[model samples]
Target chain A: AQSVAQPEDQVNVAEGNPLTVKCTYSVSGNPYLFWYVQYPNRGLQFLLKYITGDNLVKGSYGFEAEFNKSQTSFHLKKPSALVSDSALYFCAVRDGKDIFGKGTRLHILP
Target chain B: GAGVSQTPSNKVTEKGKYVELRCDPISGHTALYWYRQSLGQGPEFLIYFQGTGAADDSGLPNDRFFAVRPEGSVSTLKIQRTERGDSAVYLCASSPGVGPLYGYTFGSGTRLTVV
Candidate 1:
């Protein structure tokens, strides 16, 4: 079985400051990781994915994630946070079966 | 191009009533998925379709939940004898069968409220 964990229920960051949302996963074989963002009353939008190759994967809206194999983690990062970037974030793992974390509510303080 | 689209942005029905949610995947996307999202949780996969056939339906909660993609494009998720616990936002997503490399494009979803 595959599973994902997002330890933090909410993350607060100041606008213009960098932000990170932590995610970890457990899978039997090679992991396929993904990050998604959901705005209020909207469906989730794809951010980025880590299937293989590079560890650092850049995605839409200036978002990026680093896949750490040893740590079994893929944390989302933004060089500079924006108020518009505040939303619900989810970390998912696709190992034949796709499993998602409970999600992290991000609040970018203006 | 238009992303995945779902119908009836909001649906409120009484318990035990039957409801059908629809999804129109991207024009060329061959893979479609249905997921349910509760108030504060991440979307949970309900079913996945590769063309006209269901590739995986393990995530479906029970036999009362059924889905069909007869034409391999538009799909419908039907729920019978709905319960209050079934209330949630049903989301639809699609991906071009380009392997797992490509991510899914999601629909705005239909918010189902069981009264």
Candidate 2:
């Protein structure tokens, strides 16, 4: 079965600092990975996706993710984090089916 | 264009009652999906529709949970004999096609509370 793993339950970073949220997946075929952000009381918002071609994919809100095929990883990153950037981040992978990670709560301390 | 929209932003019902949640997908979107999200977990896929047909209903927990897209544009999820465990935020999303790269656009979601 295809599955996604988000190692951290929460990540704390200071405002204006770089942020990183790790994600890894296990799938049988070529993986299609995605990153989504959810604010309080709202549904998941699409941030970015890695389907084919480029390993480094840029997305909304200055977010970017690197898809590493060998390590089965697609970690989300931002150059400088803002306080408003804090939210729940989810990494998902598409096998034959779409499977989501447990989710990582991000806190940007000002 | 407007994003996906769901009706009844919040619904509270007694256990054993029935409830229906509605979803209107983006204009011209061919694929729609339904998911359930708990307090702290990621959304769990419940079903998927391609046009007017249900292409994947495997994620549905049981027969008590059912969904229909009669016109291939709007969809409804009906839950029978709702239990306390069924309380969660129900989300609806739409995509242009089956490709995962097309990433889904989600609605604000309906918060269902079973008393």
Candidate 3:
């Protein structure tokens, strides 16, 4: 079985400050990691993914995630946080199929 | 369609009633997937279809839940008996192939409410 976990139920960050949303996973073999954001009453939107090559992968909306092999972690990061970035963040792992974490609510306070 | 489209943005039904949710994937997408999202939770995979054949249906909860994609262009999820526990947002996504790297595009989702 494969699973992903977002340890924090919520993450609070001040506007213009850097933000980090933690994620970890347990899966067999090499894993494909993904980060998605969801707004109220909307579907998940792709943020970034780690397939191969570089440990750090850049994605849409000025977001990026680092794939740490030893730590089995893929944490989403943004150089500067924006109030509009507040939403639910999900970390998912894909081995044979996709497995998603419970989700972490990101709050950017101005 | 330019993006994945799901019909009936919101549906309210009484318990024990049968409900059908439809999904129209982006044109030319060969793979389609169905998932259920409950309050405060992530989307749970229900089924996956490759073309006209179902490649994976193991995620489905039980026999009461079924899905079909005859032409592989559009898919419908059918529930035999609706329950309050079944109330949640059902999401539909389409990918060009079977890989997370491709990043499947998702629809707004169908909000199902069983009273």
Candidate 4:
């Protein structure tokens, strides 16, 4: 069974400060990881994905993720957080069916 | 369509009634997926359609839920004897290909509420 785990339920970060949302996965074969963001009353938007090659993958809206194979982690990161960046973040892994984690609520304090 | 489109932005139905949700995937996308999302939870996969056939449907909760993609471009999710527990946002997404290589383009989703 392919499963993703987001340890933090919520993360609060000060505006302009760096932020990180942790994610880990358990899968049988090669892990294909992805990051998605959902705003209020909106659908999940694709941020970035790690299929192969580069361990550090960059995504939309100044977002990036580091895929650690040994640790089984794909953590979302941003150098400077903005107030508008506050939303629900999801970490997903694809095998046959794409499975998402519970999600972490990111709150950027202004 | 430029992106995935789902009909009925919001729907309210009485318990035991039948309701259907529609999804129009991207024009060239061959893979379509349906998911149900409850409050504060991740999207739960209901089914996946590759072309016109359902490749996987193990995520469907019960027999009351059914889906079809007759033309391979548009898909419909039909629910019978709806219950209050069925209240959640139904999301539709489409990808150009299957598996991990491509990212999906999601629709706004249909908010279904069973009263």
Best by lDDT: 4
Question: Candidate 2 — which pairs collide?
Answer: none
Across all candidates, the chain A TM-score values are: 0.97, 0.96, 0.96, 0.98
Q: Give lDDT tens digits, candidate 4, residues B1-115.
A: 8878999999999999999999999999999999999988999999999999999999999999999999899999999999999999999999998988888888999999999
lDDT tens readout by residue for model 2, B21-108? 9999999999999999998888898999999999989999999899999999999999999999999999999999887758889999
Instruction: Tell me, by DockQ, which candidate is best.
Output: 4
**C-alpha DockQ for predicted model 4:** 0.80
Q: Which regions of candidate 4 deviate over 4 angstroms?
A: none
Alpha-carbon local distance difference test for all models: 0.92, 0.92, 0.91, 0.95
> How would you encode candidate 4's per-residue C-alpha lDDT over A4-94 as one tens digit per residue?
9999999999999999999999999899999999998787899999999999999999999999989999999999999999999999999
Candidate 3's C-alpha lDDT?
0.91
Per-residue lDDT of candidate 3, residues A65-93 (tens digit): 99998999999999999999999999988
Q: By DockQ, is 1 or 3 better?
A: 3
**TM of each candidate vs. truth:** 0.97, 0.97, 0.98, 0.98
Candidate 2 CAPRI category:
medium
* C-alpha positional error of residue B12 in candidate 2 after TM-score superposition, expressed in Å: 0.6
Compared with the real two-chain complex, what DockQ does model 3 have?
A: 0.73
Error of 4 at B72 (Å): 0.4
- Candidate 1: tens digits of C-alpha lDDT, residues A24-98: 999888899999999987778989999999999999999999999999999999999999998999999875435
